[model samples]
Target: MDKRLFKEWESCVKCGICRSVCPVFKEEKSEPYVARGHITLLSELIKGNIDFSEKEAKDYLYKCLLCTTCVESCPNDSHTDTIVEIARHEVIKKHGLPTYKKILSKLLKSRQAMDFAFKSASTFSPIFAKKNNKPRDGIKLRIEVAGKDRLLPPIAKQTFLDKYGNDKKSRVVLFPGCLINYTYTEIGDAFVNILKKLKIDFSVPKKQLCCGAPIYFAGNFEDARYLAEKNIELFLSLNAEHIVVLEPTCASMIKLDYPKLFMYFEDKKWEEKARRVAEKIIDPIKFLFDQTDVLRRLKKLPIRTTYHDPCHLKRALKVKDEPREFLKAISDYTEMKEADRCCGNGGTFSIDYRETSLKIASRKVKNILDTKSEYLATSCSACIMQLADILNLKDHKEIKVYHLLELIDKALEA
Candidate 1:
């Protein structure tokens, strides 16, 4: 961790100005859990005045959604995400990770383990999916996680890479991320189809692992760094001109987080390679828009859709307009109020703080419902999962949630 960055981040005024813009604080109604409050605690830790073993400091770091909203809204332009990340790194270094997080990080770093997990999820999906009485009930089903209801999309019968394996098209490498490869392979299929339609050559790297966003958020920086090194080596071997990633979180990790984390890599060439590879990182929706002929072809879908900008994509990476423009080219695109507001699925935050996460997602669902559009399109898989669950719990079945690439693929098919 950079001590200078950590020190500057500790100087937040605790002004509460960011409270109104923070989705987590808005939902939880807790000042200590907000960005300003987290910075205050981090300041204490930085000063060596607080210990990580204390529940107050530990909970303060863990409670943050890491949505980056406060940073975006900060009058001083303080980088809150980096502050939280450094605090998290410090906490993990002191107290170590939880059992589940250790297991998750291990699975994430191992390609074989991830493949097996996806295969198992696809195998057992029918056990969780049941028939219901609504119009889209057959298409959607619920799963219970830690006593909270979650609406899970059925796993695709064939995984994305399996169907597209061995095809050497345009020579680009695909990063499907955990959720897309395991639960929502159809999104991956849509990405592949869109790339194919555009005649962009791409390949799915056989040894791809998790992009490490989950592990990074879980305060396991050691494992996260390991996964980053592994992915950097693998992508370097592929020699693709660009890395097309379907998940915004994964793309953000490769494009932004990794470079920051590996700034002082052992091999100067490795650092250079990682930076060069990061330059080619493109979200699937943005990649599709860059194809002019494809954009012209996409101007034909006749459906009404609204976009929800994922906080990571919109704020962390400043990619708010690309997905919107891509959707506009395909459909009657409507911008919902608070389009940049978070959907409250801050990876493990949704799992650890269920009630708070649900409250945040409820606001997002309300915003989408206000638009009254048929579909709510977003670029992040986790956001899609949380939004779908929130809408289902409200019994709003008419509103469909799709990845931006999925909508684009539908338009091309039409």
Candidate 2:
């Protein structure tokens, strides 16, 4: 019964503008799937017209991509996405998490457990996930656990943090996040290379954990808060001048959502600490863009590349131009149609609802193909993973997906 969530539920005028922009509605064409429709149902529940525990209500809640595109278009700035998250928290309070999700949450909380599991997964994943015939990026899996056609990048034998230890403290700290640490070490490798090439002072914090985006996004608010508290304390201890996050979602979660999490609890001390930490948090692309030392070294990469804006970077952080600034400086930049449109990754949404996620991603993939580019670049690792999967499924072996840092690292190599 959050007042802010209640306000958002009542604020929606049912304008249907959100309906037109919703990717899920485009695929499902159902009343429960669209933002306005979702708010409408939520409002009905608040008014006692519908039950919150109803399967229909729960299905509608989880079905969202959580892109916040609706917020971008909403005249009221209603924040339907925030309301949806709050509603999810409500649902979790009543039903508790499924057994698998509970186990996964525990894994996220432990460093040693995650390291062991991923180490095991790295060695055994190939046996489980078959390689694609046209594999350029990640290996595709037809296995039931991987869903119908999920393309998971091969796990790194040695993680970035494991390879590059925090020998001594530096002015800058890079937060590689979960996806980059385990699945997409290429981005992590590129990040280190770019920093080295630019002669930037940085260290990767070995103790830094997941930014708890997955937990919070999954409606495990308390667990998400636990993660945030741990990360905040560890970051404060490092006392770096800049904490450049590799994943856009991690960046936004730390910069924006971290403060909100504390404010709701009326924890003045933690909220202040979060704001201080937020000041130092920057996306790696933005960090590089601000570095004149790096700017002077940009080489015009002779490759045609198109940029896909991660929803977190574009909508949450308002960081649409920072990454593009790098692309414009280094590569033959092509603007894809609706470049800021959500690729339908929605964190684990792509895993849970594969067919719907893929259908939504088709629109984005078509937009990328329309650009006729050699490579697809984005700020978020999850976005890169999602785009790579959809492209692999379509048999587009020619195009490659890269993080902005990876592309920047390429320029430095050239």
Candidate 3:
């Protein structure tokens, strides 16, 4: 019942407009799974009209994907996603986080822990991970976890961070999140290749850690803030003009969540640093697209492709046109149905709520299939992972899933 979030909850007015656009509601067909229902529940709790046990509140709060569909469609422009985040923080503060979240928080809170876990996974990957090295697919390894296959972009022998140190001459700082640094190093490489092509001098900060999106969404706000502060300090020390991220979710987290996270604290100093860092955060596609002559250098690719809008890329950042405009310039770009719909891969959401995540992702796969395109492209690494999993598990391997950066790099080579 934080006052700021309570105010946002009060603004809902029980309108069902968010229900129409919510991907979870479409799959669950339950009021509890939609934004309106959550707002009503929060309103009731704050007004003393309803009572929920600690477990009950946790249930309602954790069910959300925080994809911002309702936030985008609300008539009053209610901040549903931020409200949901605060609600989760409140619940976790009262009842404590689930075991999985505790583990995730520990790993994400420290770069050393993340590196150790990834390196250990890489050592055992050959036995546990299956390779998918196709040109268009971002899923590099399909590893068996708890008897179910979990998708991961392959880890590099030499991490991007390990390969490059602080460069005083660079104008840009590349913040490779855990995925790009450990799991999908090729995406990091693709980014590096594209930066070289653009003649943009960028440095990969060796001290950069996880973007804390996972921990923040899972209600571990304290740890997320600590990570954010560490990142903010690290990047500011680099004295770079622009801070670029390989993953759209990372960019969204740094740009949006970092400032919001700082709001809960009385310390104004960190908020100022977060705001400065936020101002420098840029999406790679949007940054590259600004270089008009570089776009003209891309060869016309002959392959037919369609785009899947990552929720963070589209809803969080309002980046609907930049990636598309870039794709249309170099390839036969086809628009998929409900391109901006959530693919239900809210990082840990897919792992915690597999059935619902899969159901939503299946529909997205169907939309991709309907376009009859050879490849499906998106800007977020999480969306790429989920779409690749749903596409493969559903026996639609003929269609490859790719990051927009990957395609851009390929077009440069072509």
Candidate 4:
């Protein structure tokens, strides 16, 4: 942890300005869960004024969604996300990860294990669907902690990496995040098709792990750093000029979090490797937009879609225009009110604070509905899942949620 960065973050005035703009704070109306309060807590920790029993520290650190909205809103640009991550790292160093988190992180470390689980789930999915009378297209797997009724997208039959393998023609290394790989292979397939059409050489590494955002947000920074190191090595081995990531959260972790976390490495070569990896990281939409002839081809599609800017993509990366431009090319696109607002699905934040998450997503859904869009498109896989779950519950079946690349790919196919 950079002591100077931590000190800067510790000096927040708690002026409540962050609360005024924070979606989570807006929904909950609570300081404890707001960015300012989180910084104040870290301030106390840094000053040696309070001891965080493992549970207390874990709980506080886990409350953050790491959406980067607060950073955008802060006058000082206090780097709340960095401070939170550092606090999480400290906690994990002091106390080992919880049992469930440890298991999940372990599973996330192996693509083979993730693939096996997805295949198994896909095989049994039909049987379970028949027994429960749930439509195969819309299956809700109940995870107890997040809430039993939380609807999950069904697992894909084959991961994108499995289907495409590592083609030498592919100059870029694409990291299809866990959700995009296992739950929304259509999005992954669409991305591949677009890449093919653009003739952008790309490779999907066989051993890529979860970008580790979930574990990191859950206060398991040891696992997060471990996954980061593994991923850094994997990308370096690929020897690709660039790394393209489908999920905004994963991209943010690679481009922002990994370098920050690994900056203090004693080995200069490892630190240099981390920096090189960060440079090559590109969000899928921006990459697609840069290849504009693809967009020119997309301009002929007949469908209409509206976009939801995932907070990570919009506020964190400032990638607000690329998705809009991509959508405009293909369809009669409508910009929803508050298009860049947080969908409240802050990875595990939705699980940790259900009501608040839903409140924010509910507002987002209302805006999507108001647009009368045939499809609601976003760049983040987790945003798609969260918005879909909310829309499903509200019986808003007419509007579909999809990744932007899926829409672009469909246009190309037409």
Candidate 5:
């Protein structure tokens, strides 16, 4: 009921520019799915005119991707996404997370649990999930994942940390989010390979936990506060000059959200620690791009590549140009339409709202196809997975998807 939440919401002049830009609104074709409609509803909820616990109201609340596009596009800085975050936290505080979310929150907070679950799922994939020979290149699934396609990069039995997290003495800390850690271990390999070529010594601490974005954005603030402690303490203890995060979502969570999380609770000690950690957080792309002669070292590729902007990297962190500059040097690069649009992954949002997620993704696929590029490159692991899956579903499986680090590694080898 605070006035600040209403500050942005009440100021909306009913402009539908948000509808024009929202991937969800474009797909859903409903005002309720757009920022303007959400603002009206949220203002009412904040004022107690509407009950968030209503089943209809509850479903609509979670319908958002928290893509931050509308907030970024808002002329008055309406910050509808921020209101959604606060609303989700309020929902959790009132009725508690669903049973699945509780399980997810627990897993996200515990590295051991995440390691077990992902490793177990990797083990189970061969047994329960159907696989084809061209798994990475987009194989179809009978299980119907993420709307209709169950395609995902094969999970790694050996987590990146399990294999390479022991280089604990280096000046740089490599923080791979859950996807790069478990599902996309090869991305970690690529970063290490590139780092070795750049002669930049780094460490991947085995003790680092989830960046807590998954559960935190899912409405569990308590567990995120706990995770902030473990990760912040561990990173600060190493005295590493830089903490390079693989996934942009993790980077945004640690760099932007963690400080707010601590400040919200008025935990000054932890807030300071959070700020210290935030100071160290850097995108892996920026970290590498900042190095001397990085462009000179990479061998330019003849392969045509296009880039998709992950929402967190493009919007949350305002990281727009560095990746493009690096890519142009390494590959035959062309720009995709709406490069900064969401791939509809939104972590659990894609899982919980599969149909809408895939619909939004389908539009993205059309834009990608228009580029007619041989490869799609991006910074975020989640976007890599989501874009790859959607591309496969659309039968453009031959168009390979890769982490920008992987492309850099390929260039390094050349």
Candidate 6:
């Protein structure tokens, strides 16, 4: 058990303020699904008051979407996500990972293997991939895998790294994470175009792999640390002034979780290096916002849009205003109800608990409908995946979803 996290757990007052903000609790209305319930269970297990079993642990721990709303709502400001992650780590340490997690972890460990897998998936994906009638931004590929509908942006024929080799003269390094590299190349393309327009020297580091967020969230902190070390070395080798990421989750992981991963490292040099790397980490949206001349050049778009605040982007990184301010400047922006609310696509949370994930997502979709906006702009790719699916699932074709970068690219073109 993490001592710091145990202390943090002890501070929880069980005020149920977390219950009001928790998306899962709102949908499930069950104690186990809420932060207080899980914290109580964790406290019991830690104190030897309750027996820990794989089945019992998985039931409570995996239920969280890790949106951090509970933590934000709590008066004690307990690190619910961290506590839950530790609980997950303990559970996995005792009994080992399930079969799917083993396969996913292996894929995250290698870029070549992941590329090969996606290449294979791409070959067969076209057989089932269908174009959406009301495509908004990005190539909407609607497909059904095992009878479950998934709305994904078409995978790039070649990745951003494949197309844009490392430029030694570039000061900025663009970290196109797995989602942007494999599934949403348009987002990557837009980011690059925006950089080009800004005349900001940048490179896409080919050696960099997934931010290891998938593995970390899976409770495989051991492998997550290894992946983080690999990325840190790659960035250190570049000596780039800034590391820009489009996906908020990847940015949050590198900026927040990467250092946490390094805490276990005994070597002071590596820990110092991790901190250095964290300093250079930047969100493209925030970076672009800082470039005043770039904003002045963008033509105001006439499109009406609503913004979905990605939980990690808003709650974790506290990047609430930049995207909205940028959107408001570029387009006629309207605020959606509970814009910072979780879209219920907490990486594997959606995959593992599909019914609960969709239940939460339905409310999110309804909120989007309430906005009556033609476009839905957000900072996180995970949110994009969930928003796209729920919109398609409900057959609500009036609005199309976009990454904020895509919108910036549009404004730049305009």
Clashes of 5: 0
Q: What are the models' TM-scores?
A: 0.91, 0.94, 0.93, 0.91, 0.93, 0.94
> Could you tell me the TM-score of candidate 4?
0.91
What are the per-residue Cα lDDT tens digits for candidate 5 across 107-217? 888888888898888777766566643315333455655456568667787999998878456688899888888878888899889888878888889899898998888
Q: For model 5, give the 10-residue run with minimal summed lDDT.
A: 132-141
lDDT of 1 by residue, 46-165 (tens): 677877674664678888878888888788777777777877877787778777888888888887787787678667766765643231222333556633556555565666666665
Stretches > 4 Å off in candidate 6: 47-49, 133-147, 167-169, 264-269
CA displacement after TM-score superposition, residue 219 of candidate 4 (Å): 2.7
User: Tens digit of lDDT per residue, candidate 6, span 1-414?
Assistant: 324446768889888889898999998899988999989987776566886778888888898998999988889988788778767877898889998899999999999999899888777766657655443433344544422766666666787677785646468888988988887878888888888877777777778888999889878988998898999998998988888987889998999877766654355676688889999988888888875366777789989999999988888878888888888889989998988889889998887888888888888887888888899999878788788878877888778888898888888853
What are the runs in model 3 whose C-alpha is more than 4 Å off? 1-6, 43-51, 132-147, 167-169
Question: Which lDDT value does model 5 have at 263?
Answer: 62
lDDT of 6: 0.82
Which model, 1 or 3, shows the larger TM-score?
Answer: 3
Q: Per-residue alpha-carbon lDDT of model 4 for 228-323, expressed as tens digits?
A: 889998887777776888888889888887776665334456667788998889888888777446766665567778898898888767799878
Error of 6 at 170 (Å): 2.7
lDDT per residue as tens, model 2, 28-95: 98978989888877666656677765476468788998899998999877777776777777677778
lDDT of 3 by residue, 239-269 (tens): 7778888788999999988988887664578
Model 2 lowest lDDT segment of ten: 133-142
